[model samples]
Target: MMKVANPPKVSPPANEALTKDARQYGVVIGALAGFCENGSPLVSLGDRPALTAMTLVDVGEQHIGMRVAVQFEGGDLGLPLVIGVVRDNSGVGSSAGASAARVTSECGLSATIDDDEIVLIARRRITLRCGAASVTLDSDGNVEIRGKHLLSRAAGQNRIKGSSVSLN
Candidate 1:
């Protein structure tokens, strides 16, 4: 019987091999280039090609030019993960007064909260619905209200002023 030579040991994939090597390098700073088709952010690390990365912090389109800390996820087969944003010591972006929080949704809805008040915005329409009652506001300056019953109560003066008003 002819002895079969041992098969050559196949190496891991490039990313997998890079992952092992990357561990020793620790976290790297990368800039957010843009977003991928699946909405994941693409980051540029040094001179390498842009790699798709997921974020541990809340990141949006506003963060496209910001630097972020990137590291390979240990259990995720070395997929790049954005751990945090790198903020400069300069107080340029920081507010001296009350801090504000902004949240943007995937569907074009956004909200901003500050010390004074909260603001909600939507591209097309915004609707507030509770049980059988619903209030809809559209970009065309149209407000529609629907409910089983409607009530109008005011502690002070109540006024209904519009281009045209109809009552039944």
Candidate 2:
């Protein structure tokens, strides 16, 4: 009787072989976050390291500054693939579909349509606040306040020009 030993598996050298791939997180930059061209979402770590990522699905047209996670096959930065956008605590940079951008927070949910329509739907009320002015729109739509306070102050001249002027 004789016993035989099998040879060990051979692996390429570490330096000569391609590194195993892993997911890396980065921020989206450039003009339109590289979403306008197509489904390719460009992710950038800084100025030098940037690559066009092939996403699982179209991440839609995102804002200039958005967080994204990408995976590089065989640790090759040149062949990066996009997973999805990394949503922050505020819930911005969320893509509902290939043409929709949504943001949900404690305040409310806001979405930006690809065609340039911004729709804000709130459970309670919606408030727009500025430095010295504010507009409050309630859910019922019965109450609409143009400004926080009533004031007639114009830099040049105050003119009330309308088709019909009625004071109640």
Candidate 3:
């Protein structure tokens, strides 16, 4: 008689009759419709009913037309839960919704609302880098940098007024 090398592990048969939870991708059609006691954002998903999702702990806002991933209840037992947002599909840099302010990180880079007031607080140092310019502010608000600089530019005229003008 031939001996079996090893028996393969077998999983118990799934109960197809019962609802099975699954993860799915969908787009956020509506937002800010309502909120749960825990402050979870309730949003209407594409074609499906509205459901509340566990958002980022410090997420200030979620807007419509944002693509999101959701977890569907097993065997269609109940509404699905929003798991996370799909960043690549999110039209962040486009001018579609230019009026709104959005902050996000994608592809190893962080994007902030252009020309908007932003405050960065760091215990040690804060560094910003761009292809054209960079800024650094130390804990004591003293910094040194190398670059062509501009103080201010206005449509009508540029003014530089100070107690004393010294050029070296």
Candidate 4:
């Protein structure tokens, strides 16, 4: 016997469709890289002279972690995460749950993950493009760094062979 043709798939309800965005990425306004009428204020992200949406030029992600490049449109200058800065991918437009903002490194990594850092990924990488100084990993595998501002590494002197590295 010949089988009957399948009917057209039923469309989701309007409210349901809207919920999809809220569930997956987040609010619709926050998702766009442009002005959002009902989105979080620009001040919430950074204190730029003229806050605006940052364009995602590039993105570096690891598992649950992500770093996106935000191109400032001459409005917000010198603002780190707003444009040339890096922050954890955990709370992109979240009003709360912001652990701390992070910065990117030369080794294609994100550092200074806030205690708010999302541990969803084993080891993640974000980018906050900025020029930073170099440190010598001493003979004993210890590098006593000073005046450094890498939030993550500076917190702990991990894997320092023998010498003491005062990160403070």
Candidate 5:
């Protein structure tokens, strides 16, 4: 892949550019999962794993489950964040969505999916205009880039529930 491409509507998040005090870990979301004690393998086992792919429906359970472990996990979140975009093996939109915007917006930005191309609201905008369409889109066509790298485990408890996915 190219190092970078032309930006969309918005600019990238500032957090990714930090250079100090960063920690990494895996993101898991689903119904139920188990992380290997050795951190080697993750399996679905006809159900789900510790690192599960989840939707908004599972928020309640995920929140309560991490409470006990929050007092034990640790790490730093002040460093640059590098992420890898993740997709279902069959790819996105193929899951048969009901919305006109095939791809859901990450955190409210509009997005859409066209074959393999993902057009999204690039957060890389130089100026922050309230109604600029160039850096602000109103569609559902971005490729959701969810990474496997873990965020800082020491920042507190599991603060991120539906992990922040970027438009790749």
Candidate 6:
């Protein structure tokens, strides 16, 4: 009778080691490479090739080189999803006391909140509009207020001061 020997078990590819390792089942840090044709983000995990991924947090072209935390759904065979952006801690101590919150839009609108004040910034103009009333502030330092009927009332005094005050 001939002796029979079992074949050796093959190991998984090195790139797939992340999913195979039980210890790495948790969130993994990845760099945002770019976006696919379908708008899905492509992430690079260490030396592995970039893989298309979904994101729970909003990501734009501006965040292409940002670091993000990726979590695999189900298990090693599940899809990869970007959970959150990893904030850079280098500037953590730049603001000592006040905590700031900021929101920026691609259309050149930004709002920032720091301590007790809120500041709004825009590239061209900032306008507040209602039914027939609108106030506009332009980049040229022009302030325009329009309304059907305008009234100025103050508890103590009301003053209208400008380079040249006009009343008609």
lDDT of 1 by residue, 1-168 (tens): 877699667445456666667787788877665565478877666545567777898877777656778887662333678887777698322221245545454445555557898777878888878899999999998899999988999999999998898998
- Model 2, range 1-168, lDDT digits (tens) per residue? 765587666443343233432323343322223432344555554333345656664565444346566665445556556666666577877432445544433223333346567676666676667786767777786444565568789899899876797998
TM per model?
0.43, 0.35, 0.30, 0.18, 0.17, 0.40
Q: State the lDDT at 145 in candidate 3.
A: 59
Q: Quick one: ranking by TM-score, best first?
A: 1, 6, 2, 3, 4, 5
Residue 39 error, candidate 3, Å: 1.5
Best candidate, TM-score = 1
Clash pairs for candidate 2? none
Q: Lowest summed-lDDT stretch of 10 residues in model 2? A: 23-32
**Model 5, span 42-62: residue lDDT tens:** 112112112322222222322
Candidate 5: where is the Cα deviation over 4 Å? Answer: 1-56, 59-94, 97-108, 122-168
In candidate 4, which residue ranges exceed 4 Å CA deviation?
Answer: 1-107, 116-140, 145-168
Which segments of candidate 2 are over 4 A away from where they belong? 1-32, 36-39, 94-168
45-91 per-residue lDDT for model 4 (tens digits): 23212233334333222212232333322222322223322344664
Who is ahead in lDDT, 2 or 3?
2
Q: All predictions: root-mean-square deviation over Cα? A: 11.3, 15.5, 12.3, 16.4, 23.3, 14.0
lDDT of each: 0.69, 0.51, 0.45, 0.33, 0.27, 0.67
Clashing pairs in 4: 80-85, 85-128, 86-128, 99-116, 112-152
lDDT of 2 at 104: 34
lDDT of 6: 0.67
Alpha carbon lDDT of residue 86, candidate 5?
28
Number of clashes found in candidate 4: 5
Residue-wise lDDT of candidate 6 within 36-122, one digit each (tens)? 557887766655556777789998866755677888654442356888777757731122124554544334455555778877677
